[model samples]
Target: MTDRHDHPAAFVDDMSDRAEQIADAAMRLFARYGFKRTAVDDIAKEARIAKATIYLHFKGKDDILRATLQLLGQRVDALCREVMEMKAPFAERLMALLRAHHCTAFLSIGAGDHFAELRAVIDDIAVKERKAFESIFVRYATQLIEECEARGEITLKRPGVDPAALITTLMQASVGAKVGGISYEDYEARLGLFAGVIIAAVLP
Candidate 1:
């Protein structure tokens, strides 16, 4: 019952669109009702798609949860690609990329109880999706640093201090900044300072 030739690219986009919709709806339900309490039927109602239609795109509730986390990763990854093409300076672009990765996830899971529940569900079931996002961020961040160096925007002052190592340190510090229960404003402030410290000696 499908078009004989939906055009491969267009077909893929359509699939992504539907799957993303289902995942979006699921994430809202998971955040509001807790992941365990949110039934597949609830997701179908939220998405306005039949339960059967969801199965066409996802295996079940767990798969839908994974897809929801993946949506966050995709958003960050797409933002990084967009920032890469911007005419902005490396520092500005780097900050945008940082927000693209961190703020995006923060807003997606929301605050307090929502963040706790969603994070627990992700850890319990969608660990790969969570880890994949980190990997995606590191890959892009490392590339951005390399590009900045190549453009003479930055240079490593110390031998053996490479982009990957520097980025890993920045990322670890950024994650550490989230500890001890911080507000969004505090988190953003800390992120700015941490990033500055990591890039200080490298930037002219």
Candidate 2:
């Protein structure tokens, strides 16, 4: 039976499907070839679409790269929010935050030699977008730090700890597991020790 409602709905669904297909194709090619080496032709081939069809969706290779990265950053922000929103203890929230980063799509995409290009691309983002990304990290980390402080889990001196500095330190320390040769397990263990030390230093 033909349905009148199906036409518009089907068109929207088709558009969504094609968009996802193109994005997925871009991700795959970019992962393999990095931003500098990945061309519109590579993405089109990976997507099984003509070059013109690729242009119909994305302006060019840079557009595709930006779209892919923005998508990844959004997912990271979401995961961080989920951890912050959890009803668990401070330690558990910290664990969830670490776990989220450990298993995120961004991490998967950042693996291999191509990851340097990903960092370079991030460095190239507009100042506003870059600041927004920084704010997201700060927001999540500040919440975790406050939770730790409230629970007397961390001690601060009379001068007190700078929440922003602590957050940045922890985050950069966490990244060491990635771009460095250290394994996640080792990094996590070290992080636990670092957390303990930080808490002891900050708590009354």
Candidate 3:
């Protein structure tokens, strides 16, 4: 029920740029120190802006956390849209989607040595935002799978191969890969193989 725009200074013309700076700084600090240990002053110092300046575009630390997660979500969504818009076969498009998802996961969650700590911080403050973003991701994946099936690009061989479930399983596999400390190259290769296997199973 709390509208972000209800804040008096939220409408500044340069708000988007400022918010990006604040979020970037916050993400770095959160990665370095964990969320509970990072303070607004730390972000302000890292961003080279006054603490009050951050508040001009965000309500507080939690707001900044939400904004940061939203930015990441937007990046993933953009990648999904790009894959969907490609003039390629459904199999190629699906591979592209899986590659994009892996790349995004690597950048967002695997790049940092302290990612587990950072993830815990985010989970505490933005569980709903995370869940919503994941739901959108799953929806996109499901749409792609259904479209492929409809176009005769893929046929469901297994009796109950739900697209949503398949996508969810893939997502969990990617998370496990990251948590297991697999190198990005290794993870991508594994994902490529996994995608191939999934496509092969459903191929007519």
Worst 10-residue lDDT window for candidate 2 reads: 101-110
Model-by-model lDDT, in order? 0.80, 0.67, 0.77
In what order do the candidates fall by lDDT, top score first? 1, 3, 2
Cα RMSD, model 1: 3.2
Off by over 4 Å in 3: 1-11
lDDT of 3 at 77: 87
For candidate 1, write residues 1-204 as lDDT tens digits. 778265898888888899999999997888677787899999999999999999999999999989988887888889878877888777787778788887666556643455666767788998888899888778888788888888888887677767777788777766666666577778778788877776675777
Q: Top model by TM-score, which number? A: 3
lDDT of 1: 0.80
Q: What is residue 94's positional error in candidate 3, in angstroms?
A: 2.0
- TM-score per candidate, chains pooled: 0.81, 0.73, 0.83
Question: Relative to the unseen true structure, what is the C-alpha lDDT of residue 25 in candidate 2, on a scale of 0 to 100?
Answer: 80
Model 3, position 98, has a per-residue lDDT of 75
Candidate 2 C-alpha lDDT tens digits along 1-204:
976467998977876667667777887777677877888888888888888987777777766766665555676788998888888766667767765654364344655667667667857853444456556666887878787778776655446477777777766665554565444466567667656655555656
Residue 148 error, candidate 1, Å: 1.5
Evaluate model 2: give its TM-score.
0.73
Q: By TM-score, is 1 or 2 better? A: 1
